[model samples]
Target chain A: MAKQFKSLHPIKFYRDYLNQNVRPDGRLLSKFRPVIVNTGSIATADGSALVRIGKTTVICGIKAELAQPKAEKPKEGFLICNVDLPPLCSSKFRPGPPSDLAQVTTRFVADLILNSGCIHLRDLCILKEKLVWCLYADLICLDYDGCLIDACLLALLTALKTVKLPSVDYDVAIDKKVVNEDEKKSILIYNTPVSTTYAIFEDKIITDPTAEEEDLSSGLITIVVKEKELCSVHKPGGSPISEEKLYDCIQETIKRADLLNTLINTAISEQTH
Target chain B: MNVIDDNNLLMRKVNCKLDILSRPDGSVLLSQGDTVVIAGVYGPIEVKTQKMLINKASVETFYRPKSGTPGIGDRLYESIIQNICETSLVSALYPRSSIVVIIQEMQNYGGIISCAVNACCFALLNSGIDMKFLVASASCALDDKGVFHLDPDKLLSDKAKANFVFVFDNIAKRIIASHTSGSFNLAQYEEALELCKKACDAIFDFYKTKMKNEIANKV
Candidate 1:
């Protein structure tokens, strides 16, 4: 229930919040939750991380395996993201199967990483198309208080930072054409991206909303960035946002991006130690 | 000739929990060494007419085991989970309504049931009984190459000969629901049950730890 049962009454609460430029959480036009990031939580995974934004907690694990590449992208390695929300995270989520919500969100995250060039695709290449590294980044919600989009992004980044692939030897199987673990490959990484989310409740533009605020919101704006440029923006719902607000959101996200970039680096540094 | 030692492969797991979730009747996470499982119980709520049976409160259960999405989004599989839950639960006491239990396997490897059943028991206990007994556990197992292993990991799961899932009531010491795939021989079936017992006994230790943690935290 990301939307509060306030209407069918008047104007949408989220729209009104955006209009006033005051978020329900009492922040300015732009703000992010107090967040923390860590890594190596799942030692079994090649890379793993746990991220917390306020109360929203997400765990992301990355596993690398050898697989054949597609004919079209034979030179590039494989990347797959499965974003899961177990029912325990929220009362609204039902148990059983993947929801339409999960599918759309996963696409948004994947595109964000793909376009941002967070991973060095060439590093995953092995033996032309016969074998390559298949990276599976699995995101699980431990506690979804709100602003899950942002928390998920943070977790993804943290997991990517810690993920180290086994060293690859293309000549390991010169005759048999099989890659073996006689040696492991160095970790392959490119740049990293951070995602920020905003919820509109009336005129107030709330940043990193709590679950209650999320339900009250009419619409939300998610922004993913790398250094200075924007990687992606995902908006899902009936309510529409204006270009002016979107720009403000972007400008505001710039400031948050710097902070987020710093945090990610610090977390990654701690993880390596 | 070098072979991997079964003892060194890490065989067991445990969890410490308190009342974690706010809305559930009760909840717990059971980990069999990173094969993580979370189970929650909610209900005795008023049931929709179509869902209600004239006699007893229909039990609804949902399972999502990190493999891949199964047939439907929980609506279809809820019945299977509910049946597994009801077999050991005192559903008769909460008649004409519904008791919904949800199980999620987050980090799946193998022997998912061994952990799932344990989590389910902890959640049921937390849901505030209507219990006929103290606890119940369930496990899905397989045996290959005549080696009777308890709680196989993902690597072993791929090579297993049969898939056996059993639900048991700890109070009655009875096997409530035992299901076996066609691959195993009669002797294998007997051996798997014996292994299932070992798995169940291990999971019960997890159940106790969760209870103690919950009690200490008063969560």
Candidate 2:
């Protein structure tokens, strides 16, 4: 049966599918899995979202807590991003502490959030240096199929869109803070940065690979597009790729970003309604 | 002791997916309402010399919280899960090897311990590991008014006077583990146990349905 062939000679099975111009999962080389986004699902957190791309599921929750602003950046607040890839997601990850992949992904997501100017930290400042809203954005991988970075970024962005901070009245002289829970305001997001991951198998470049595909491929490239500009083009040292192929990946990401923007917007609107 | 009504005995909505992760021998993501936990099983593999056992497979558990390093509370959870897995697994079949069950707490609304235990059970089943019997877990909260709330949310749990988590095996529906916090009388504890025991039945049925679907898909 085909299942036996796939398990026994996986490379040959994949090559056979590639020869026919399709993937083992019946997706075209450039086709991506359907992305479904649901926002404000976790009631305990200030903002939360569940994003699913194919079978890879990620949930992001943002908890906004009051904290004193740093001495250097008194006008800005904090946005700490952490991505957890526990052993439950994949067997490659162990049970001890955060693995290298998890730490790298967290740094990448944090860098993206900062460089993209998606959120203005100053907007989070309530009483300048006295008090500010420190948003702790924690991304958890419930299912690890593939395209982990793409799913984590999407979940964080969507969850950030749903964040609502209560109105706080701070008396500077008395240093008293009274929070009005009734009047809540959402955060201001400037740019919507969307990332797309592709696997480079020999000379063929495939987008949104599953876990199996990622392993068989030689290299991986992730293109992050924000509006018409390129936010980041990350290639974590796989096989060498030509400039033209890189440019093509950027173009594909641009198109994908537009579609994702609409998807996020519709999901947020649906949550509000 | 205040008796819980039959209408208040229902658990939260349960959702689960088995074998969702690659690389792991078996994995499961289970959610009870908004409290989600994912568990993976890697077993009958190489064991560290210091921790190796001569007559049975050593069972180990790791509990990862949503964020930051695992604290003392998390370590307690790990041990609780470790004990449950050690007892249920037929480790004598694979001597000198080890079985590791890692549970990641995705979202914690309430009753997270129960969710993690159930998720671990499902992951072990998915790994096709030999076990004495399947286990199911359920939790309930007792408010100040002595009313029992099955599968209480964060708000309810925070306001509760006591909370209880109980695990039962499928073979005899007997208690495999019991964890409780807050102040409560002996009579109240007994009533809470009875309530959770009923809720465990629903969880057991859920596992059966999910396993049947998995087999059907494979066929």
Candidate 3:
């Protein structure tokens, strides 16, 4: 369910804020809140991460299991992403199946995964036609103050960076002379796909829509990007956007992606030690 | 959970490694794939009596989401702790007093409430607050594919049976509070109790290490 928050209706504030473009939060439209990323924060899973963007908080975890490959993608393993916004997070959501928002988010994640090159499909394949690793990327929003896409991206990136697939262990062991039984190491991560969402309202393109802004938004475009490359894009509304606005969005995303990736990479690195 | 997660078997449950936090009186970070949850505990300080003395120490729980904000889960947590806290703690002895149980959720992949209980137990003990018999573990309904997953992360949790209600403390050991959903067959109920026992034992090991190091760190 969409959040039921209303804009503060700061008409004067907007005019002044837009002139110099200083947000009430003391940030430019392109500037995001202080971001924090932490990985290995969830012990029960193979890998986990939490990302907080200002007031928005998102958590993502990766679970890889042995499964059969798809009919077409038999050589490479498959990945599934599911997003959940529980009723507890907001009264708007009731306890039930995946909502429309979740479905969209899931699709967004799949696009991002493909576009960002976060995981190597080859490494996920355990054996040619025998075994494969089906990684389940589950994203959960504990709170939705605003800028959910950015927070989700932050969480997803860190979770991917910190995930470790256990080494394959053989049941056979030699007595006198040690033997090998096709042992394998951890799964390899290729690149990072960061999702950047921009909410448009009243001819203004807000980089990271807060709760109020999201409520009053005309439409939003969430783009998934890899290093200096566009991976996927999710624009829900049918609103006709300008080429300038689209290009502007990408430019802001490039800068934002760099910052996000750095934050997540550094956090994951710290947890390793 | 079986009713849920049926569509995508890949989106099922997995074994959880409970207990992972340095601070807090107790901590447990549970995960189900990409859904992560870090639960921390703090408190058992002085409380008010006659605030409705029920011949037991009152248990007060505060749940803070990852963003340091309060949402609807806070209500569920407050009531859950209130319902189970008395039975979990030596409430009768400290009547008119209070035991503050604060749970901070760092990330919630799914089945977080159960993980919260597990964290609460560890946190209460981590705080070195005396309690009654050990409070067992808790987990939600398992997923489809006949997989009785331990902790249903967000994906599995959202699809659980209506009455799946989240079993806590286990039957074989001791139960602080559990939904009287009355849906589970006798055998299934018994199995859940056993599962909690195993989960409890495993989590306690982590708690032991956390408490030892936390106490030592102070020194």
The fnat scores of all predictions, in order, read 0.00, 0.00, 0.00
Q: Using lDDT as the measure, which candidate wins? A: 2
lDDT against the true structure, per candidate, is 0.66, 0.85, 0.60
Candidate 2 CAPRI assessment class: incorrect
lDDT per residue as tens, model 2, B1-219: 122446566677899998889978899999998999999999888999988989899988889999999865576577668768876889999999999999999999999989999999999999999998888888898899999999888898888877777777887675566655554554676677778877888788888888999999999
- Measured with C-alpha atoms, the lDDT of residue B127 in candidate 1 is 83
For model 2 the local lDDT of residue B28 reads: 96
Q: For candidate 2, what is the DockQ?
A: 0.01
The TM-scores, one per candidate, come to 0.51, 0.56, 0.50
RMSD to the true structure for each prediction, in A, is 20.6, 22.1, 20.3
How do the residues A1-273 of candidate 1 rate in per-residue lDDT, one tens digit apiece? Answer: 335544553345545555667654666555566887887899899888899998889999999888888999888887888889889888767798766456555756775676566776777887786778899999999887887778877888778777776655555456344445555554655666777788766545677778877766655666666666555544432133444565567677767888888888898888668
Best by TM-score: 2
Q: Candidate 3 chain A: minimum summed lDDT over ten consecutive residues — where?
A: A170-179
Tens-place lDDT per residue, model 3, B108-148, is 66655666666566556655666654454445454444345
Q: Which pairs of residues collide in model 2?
A: none
Candidate 3 runs further than 4 Å off: A1-20, A169-185, B1-219
Better of 1 and 2 by TM-score: 2
